[model samples]
Target: MSSRTTDGRSAATTAALLAGPIVMTAGMAATPWESENEITAYQAALAASPDQTQIAAVLLFFGYALMGLAFLSVLRRAGGAPRALRIPAATLAFCGATMLPGLVVVDFYDLALIQSLPAEQAAAVGERAGDYGLQPVMQVPAVAGLLLGGILVMLCAWRSGLVGGWAPALVAAGLVASFAVFSGVTMVAGASCSVVAYGGIALRLRSARIPSSPPAARPATA
Candidate 1:
């Protein structure tokens, strides 16, 4: 593609990536319920307005999807890294991004069940799902993917100078804080960091000139 076309694509990808955090922030704002693993609380929140819960879940799913695409865009832009580093970074980020949708889907299903089923029945089903290890099984990997992948991507971005040093560092720190605390404040902080990093990159892409030559392809070694 021409440099102009490449620049345009980068700009578009950045926008998509930026949308993830924005949507996530909005979803959280709309649903003020704590994200703790409190079935009773969650059910009560969903019971208050099933439609709103569903809408929030949908928004979260799209946000995650867009974030994944943004990670891919960053990976593409990270041509400065060695092939070895880039490959693993891309792989981890890709796996994490792909897993996000599954996590959102499972969460949405649980929310839907809470919305549709009677309180006692929903609680029973939700408890059973947890007892069966379904919740942790799905959640652990998804969270790991998102966290680990994001960390690696941020590191790559830092090393590649795709974004400012402080942005990725702040994002990484926010991620760590969110994981450690699991509170609304920490979550919002992390999401805000993501918004800044990705939004900054997007703005850069819009103004910067695209490189003339594509990144060199790594050669196969026997």
Candidate 2:
């Protein structure tokens, strides 16, 4: 364990590791489909079920927040991973944690656009926003961060002997489904994988032993 890590921080690290993915996956599953440039219908859906869309956005935000919060622990807990491996993984994870979650803010903004603007005007701004937002400039790092970074972290975890095969396997499948397949069913499936990957990590973290430390650092003492 690092010098700064305390029982509360450790617990939070593990909890965030598990909870972030669960909430993010739930958000993905809950996400309403974007219209196929049918701006009118898109507006209508937002009008009809703004709650669902907003809820998805909210969930996604928390997911990202949890992930970002878990970043330090992820880096620290890479266990026996090499610096070469750790650097890139940490970079991607950082980008994902910081960038991806904030994208959900766009969802709320979209909802607001729909609610506040005239139908035609909302569509115009929405289309313009989507164009700028989904640009590869933003997506590449975001995807690399959340998806590839996560995959690598688990790989590092496996390498470090911190976890077994299931953790890496689950994260791989989960990332592919959540980001690559990018559909509702796949999202749900990916979310299931998230549960196993990070959640499994948390379980392993609990079961694993810590080196001797001050009492405040060990929750078992608490």
lDDT leader:
2
**TM-score of every model versus the real structure:** 0.78, 0.76
Could you give candidate 2's per-residue lDDT for residues 80-192 as a string of tens digits?
88888888888898899888876767777767888998889998997786687558788789867987888778788878877788887887876666556555677678767
lDDT at residue 51 of model 2 (Cα atoms): 90
lDDT of 1 at 173: 89
Least accurate stretch of 10 residues (summed lDDT) in model 1? 28-37
Error of 1 at 200 (Å): 2.0
Give the residue spans of candidate 2 off by over 4 A: 1-10, 34-45, 116-124, 132-135, 179-181, 210-222
Candidate 1, clashing residue pairs?
A: none
Candidates' C-alpha lDDT: 0.73, 0.75
Task: Please give, for residues 160-219, the per-residue lDDT of candidate 1 as tens digits.
Answer: 877778766887888888779877677777777878877877776665765567899999
Which 10 consecutive residues of model 2 have the lowest summed lDDT? Answer: 213-222
Judge candidate 2 at residue 195 and give its lDDT.
Answer: 67
